[model samples]
Target: MIEEFVREKILNTYAKRTTKSKELWEAARKVIPGGAGSGFRYYEPYPIFLKRGSGSRVWDVDGNEYLDYCMSFGALIAGHAHPKIVEAVKEQLEKGSMYGIPHEKTAEYVKELLRRFTAMDMFRLTNSGTEGTMHALRLARAHTGKDKIVKIEGCYHGAHDYLLVSVFPPLSKAGPRWAPTLYVHGEGIPLLTVKNTLVAPYNDVEAMETLFRKHEGEIAALIMEPVPMNMGLVLPKQGYLKDIRKLTEEYNILLIFDEVKTGIRIAPGGACEYYGVDPDIVVLGKAIAGGFSAGAFGGKEDIFSNIYPLGHAVHAGTYNANPVAVTAGLTCLKHVMTTHAQSQMNDLGEDLASGVKAAVEDTGFEAQVPHIGPSGTVYFTDVEVVDYRTASTYDKKKNWEFWFSLLNHGVLTPPGLLEGGEQWLVSAAHQKETIEKALVITESALREIK
Candidate 1:
């Protein structure tokens, strides 16, 4: 059983500390569904309503400060209100917010992205990652002339109907391991939408090949997160990406890497550069715009050439390349997020991971902290979490205890919207002292659970 006393104590402390947040939540629920903008921001009790942030810290409505690791769900890699990003946005705002017509910043920003991701010949910008992935899939289907698409079991591309299959299904309804059944993640997703989307186990090349063979020429593309963050930062096993690339080529299937979360955070070129594997299409979002709402997709010239004004495909948006977002993104990529900054952030991530792992061991907790680049997750399990299946075995009650304890002690990780594990993102603004303090808090939380 969960330590009821410990749980109650932490909840009591949190409730007392954030009295203003509770009041705001009650007022917000009348208009906003679930009292929050995104479903991921809510929790069992009420979510903490934030007021403002600067650097690696944030203040809630109650004025309680926290060393923020959530970092806008891993989008603010340069940290909240970084001076460079703030100045860029301010300068752009003074000039203008949006111009429906084309602007010079659009080309300037795309050039910076292309410089990092050399594999992409040309790219198109959208308002968000969802739009980027949606257009990318349409292009893939048009280029290959196929209707079906294959996706990893737990990988999340976006909220679009076509890619929402088998995100986090119950094991009882998940079918088998190798050939998993596709279950619609939520309501409003039509049965016809999921019929053509195939599901395959992550980290299993043979299973992926089997799905390809079974579907044959019907499958147009296989889109997945090179290192899945939605399922708690599950890394691709050794040679897993390379093998998948070969298999896709052999089957004449388009390989699209949905790097929405991993892009710009993992490396300059994202997973393709870190893993040394080139995909047909790469979808980027999050940190690319330095916390602004933005998305981009790029690939070989032949595929994107099929877009409007060139071919028959239709891809258009009024805010396709918003000048404000482009200016902020360009400033972040060209100035703030340099090669040296990425290396420093990565080293900080390693330090945080090691420190947390040591604390777990010292406390005799059956847990593991797996990290890559600047992101990591704390899995409350003894076994190695290779994929979603293993990650699902984590202890939920312990997870809640750990998260609540951290919050009570002034540290903020991701709210428990995702079930498998909890991820902590180290930002460029976090100093070594901040990491040490977080580690100390983690040890205290683990001890309280014990």
Candidate 2:
């Protein structure tokens, strides 16, 4: 009864304040598939449509301003309309957006990426993270002459078919503890694609080895988010990443770290630098472009030698390194997201995560906030979220109530119904003041819930 009352109250407040957004959503549903550009952007009570954003804040179409924690799903590390990013985009805009040809900034951008990633010798740019992982997997298959791939159960590696298996699958159908069944994320994926993909539980080295021994030479590579953000930022157990790296090497399977979310956000070198575990290939996106659409996959020169004009594995895109996106990315890496900026954001992220954890405790909420660097998630689960099965045990109704209350209180989390799998990010633009503001709102919302 209390849960129902709290939920109704929050929903009423949201509906009252976001009438304009509601109307826009109603109109958008007619034209767009899910009333938003992406499936994740739409939610139960209609997603908020933002007009514009500045440092640390976004104004909704309904005129409500929020301390934007979504940060474009952790892509906007420099924050919304960051002055440096804006200037870079404007300057590149004058030069030209797309050239169907090579430009100077593309090489400059890759050089900076190579410096940061350290493990990657050569790099190729793509339009989105999906393309990066897609090409990286294809390169793996081509290089190893293997057909199958292994992916973490809950880790998401973009929209491609190869790595799309078992992301957020129902616990009932997810099979056993160590060995999980291959459950396709959605329909339209052919059985051949599903058959070629293998699933292993995250953080379980034994399970990973089990799959490796079971598949042996058939597996091309094992792709994973070193610290998976898709399942709401589950950190690898101590030595988990190192063990995986060693096992992959022993088994002759290439290790691909999908650092698309973690690349620039966790640290300058991302999980590779943070954890000191080097993989065969590093897939990067999100914060690398500082809000622009960009992705890159790179590793040892010999591996990437398979891509295009050089070798058999084909890779081509007209907008692969569109000058504008590269300019934004270049400026972000060299200027905005410097070592100091990364440290500051990490400090702020720690504060935000601490505050959220405190609020949960004070409000007697059974929840956990697992954070690293500039990203964290509020998992309303009693069980510690270590893997997909544990993460799925979270109370969805209570999470919905908590999310709605936070939204009503002017704090925007990631958009979705079951956002237990999503996270809140702190951008470089966020300072102590913005974090304090969010904490106040978070505490108040926590108190309002049961």
Total clashing residue pairs per candidate? 0, 0
Model 2 Cα lDDT, one tens digit per residue, 111-213 = 9999998988999999899999999999999999998999999989888887778998888999997999999889899888778899999999999998899
Indicate the residue-level lDDT of 43 in model 2. Answer: 75
lDDT of 1 by residue, 83-105 (tens): 99899899989988989999998
TM-score of each: 0.97, 0.97
Badly placed stretches (over 4 Å) of model 1 are 1-6, 417-422
In model 1, what is the error at residue 96, expressed in angstroms?
A: 1.0
Top candidate (lDDT): 2
